[model samples]
Target: MSLEFELCLRRPFTLLAHEALLNIYYSASCLKKKAGEFLRPFGLTDVQFNLMMLLKYQSEQDEGLSQARLSSMMLVNRANITSLIDRMEKADLAIRTPAPADRRSNIVKLTGRGKELLAQIEPLYTKEVKRIMAALKLNEQKTVIEMLERIRGNVSEINENTTQDVSLVRA
Candidate 1:
């Protein structure tokens, strides 16, 4: 049977619920695309911007981070992280060096240029974030974040269960 038929047969409610979830995903994707366009002139993708922020945050603690750890923290594949790091390196925004403690892994360090870019972008990013959040009251924004976190937790649990079931079937 087709996937839709299977979904409907297994749990019609789930199928209906997924429509709303899909709509949220699509809408978020569109918004991200627009935000990416805005950031393009700054020579940053959303992910790259996020990485720069992460690095800046860590710098405050006097801690350096590894690319592999960053990939895991960001929930992205290593190959993608490598490519992103490569691009950033070429732009002179960051550098990759062999970790002093681990020969196998490379640490990603933000350069002076990266810090400068982050400083330049912070105000604009903050303004955009505030403008986006302005649609909701302060309390509403908190509630929305809580609700999304709950949804994410639920989805993660379901994924884990599904993976276990598939493994059982294979066994």
Candidate 2:
């Protein structure tokens, strides 16, 4: 369906670019909400599930990941990560301990319960993801991957130019 029709807008989009941007944003928002709903029955939020997966896959050692490291990897703020860890800790899904190499910083690791939960959820999650993407053929999916990468590159360029322009104005 067209973006205007989906949005119930009386008027057309001002430009094709505007319509495309809105489509992407709307699609992303809907996907996030759907992901949240899918995980809700398992007593996990999308962010929490993402953190657990990162812990399971990204940790190179048994000691787990530093809060700083997880924040960077997740592209979220440290404070938000802290709160998420705190909630996970309360649920016994994860643990925070002083990093062996740096006592001042905390490392986040999945608890045994977390690992078990992830083990149970992963297969179902993968199946659901496949079902969701089944609307697109394999070739179409590949084309989408390429287009999204290009969009990301363009967005990065815009961000860099915006930062430079702001600094110049400040100076």
Estimate the Cα RMSD of every predicted model relative to the unseen true structure: 6.2, 1.3
User: Stretches of candidate 2 above 4 Å error?
Assistant: none
101-166, model 1: which lDDT tens digit per residue?
A: 889999888888988998999999999989877989999999988989999999999999999999
lDDT of 2 by residue, 76-121 (tens): 9989999999999999999999988889999899999999999999
Q: After superposition, how far is residue 73 of candidate 1 from its true place, in Å?
A: 1.9
Over the full model, what C-alpha lDDT does candidate 2 score relative to the true structure? 0.94
Task: Report RMSD for candidate 1.
Answer: 6.2
